[model samples]
Target: MSAESPPGLDLARLRSRLDADRPGLVTGPLSARLIEGGRSNLTYVVDDGARTWVVRRPPLGHVLPTAHDMVREHTVISALGSTAVPVPPTVLLCTDDAVLGAPFYVMDFVEGTPYRRRDQLDALGADRTRRIAEAMIDTLARLHAVDHTEVGLTDFGRPEGYLERQLRRWGKQLDASRSRDIPGIDTLRERLSARLPNSPAPTIVHGDYRLDNLLVDDTDRVTAVLDWEMSTLGDPLTDIALLVAYTEGEALGDEISSVATAPGFPPVRDLVARYTATSGRDTSAMGWYLGFAFFKLAVILEGIHFRHTQGKTVGEGFDRIGASVAPLVARGNATLEED
Candidate 1:
């Protein structure tokens, strides 16, 4: 790629800053390509002659405070470099807004495909798909087993009442973003609050742990676990639950008639078993955690629906997402009852 600046970025200023940061560092003609998939952040693939890098910044227009803390994201990824987890190498973090009009971080871009749907998995073959899934689970188990204090993440999150704060925080977010009151949203929130599960010792939890967030190589190994924006110290079960929620009815155990054919992924029980074996943690309360995960994702999707109703969301899918919230809440309630 040439040293020319890519569209939507300030080339001259960025070049100047780069020159100042590392004298004689070669940055050839820069071409910016917007990467799709995420709705909350603006991600670009920038190539400068000899090397390619990824830039992550907040989306344009109004945004919530501390919503996209690039510094925090950069810090976490940088810290993970020494861990067993696979993470992209962070090159630079620019808190100075003058460069990109917002805080941004550049990291070495990893090459792999994100598994977003069943077709993608099928394309990779059943054996490869299963291997990738297992690798993902193992990677998450390793992350949760890491000692936060040893890795300089002890101060990353406030563990005291973390679950309570999350419940309140997301509840407030839903209230602020709701365009219309869907049936059962209030009841769901109330039930989630009342049935808060027993809190375990805090560990690093990836708030979103779905197939789409992972990059799998041809050999079915996880090249990288992307999107650490929602990562923090919290109940490790929270991470496991989110993984279960993403696979619920879609991949885990028996397929639900309401949903389509199973994605052929391992059952949640087996996943928990693997994690327990790897991390030496008890699996007794996994059901409650899975319920919590579904409930949280439902609230978040509802927020997207609210944005869609206000004509804020682009493209299709948002219209029907609001309808899934109730089912997710019911799933959560059912899990709690089972416990």
Candidate 2:
């Protein structure tokens, strides 16, 4: 045992801790890889020859205090354990920084594909594609339908002023990451502020919900809804609207839109209708919500663009992100004009 940790993980330390806390949890040696190390949090997969588990921790180096709270992610997932929502089972939660130099949690590994391309769904055929899309919405409805109070999540977040706070928060994020002026960015933000829709009764708002964020098994079942770094009690419509925004852009030839171009993924209108009927919430002001979603996404992408400029970003799509921003801000303004 050389006491050397593989890149992004102190496997030796992790193994020692697991052996001390829960003996037999890790049999044999351990290897880990940083699977998803993006804006929200860094995720890794650890395998012990026979069994595997997923690990989540804050991004290396610069970390936003409230953005990637391991305990918050652990808390929400643990709370949703009994709900119809399919989340990976928690194996262990370690908040102590000594074990891994940062707080992290381990959960049962979920086997599923996070469909991020229309071509991927196209291979599944239209029927299966539609089924998966429908399941995504149904699961979202089921999640929103959960009574937070009864689930002991009443204090998970302060739902009051959630939407307003979100607007201010993202605006600050954008300003902090600003490198250049984005056309129509301020206009879109101002319009969203001017016409803030009266939010419905708050439910769990998965801050960044979309197809790629969900894992669908071969049976077309959403085995787990991954990425709870942004989960909180807030206007549920924000989640739905972000879904619509991504699909809407994809349908318009936007590369980052990712899904919704398949033959039978169902129309955005149908999806909205399904959510309305399933969740029993009025979606009349979805246009405003969708526009707000666009603004939020534009800001997010711009922040990524800034990071990429500073050579702080990892991955391939950074070059195209700045190109995506102006169009999104423009679309956000246009979407608000809809009836």
Backbone clash numbers for all candidates listed:
7, 0
For model 2, residues 295-322, the per-residue Cα lDDT tens digits are 9888877767776777755455667777
Model 1 lDDT-worst window of ten = 253-262
lDDT by residue for model 1 over 235-293, one digit each (tens)? 88888778778777353322111111325566767777888888887768787677767
For model 1, state the Cα shift of residue 126 in Å: 1.4
* Whole-model Cα lDDT of every candidate shown, in order: 0.73, 0.83
For model 2, the superposed segments whose C-alpha errors exceed 4 Å read 1-7, 36-39, 251-255
TM-score to true structure, per model:
0.88, 0.93
The best candidate in terms of lDDT? 2
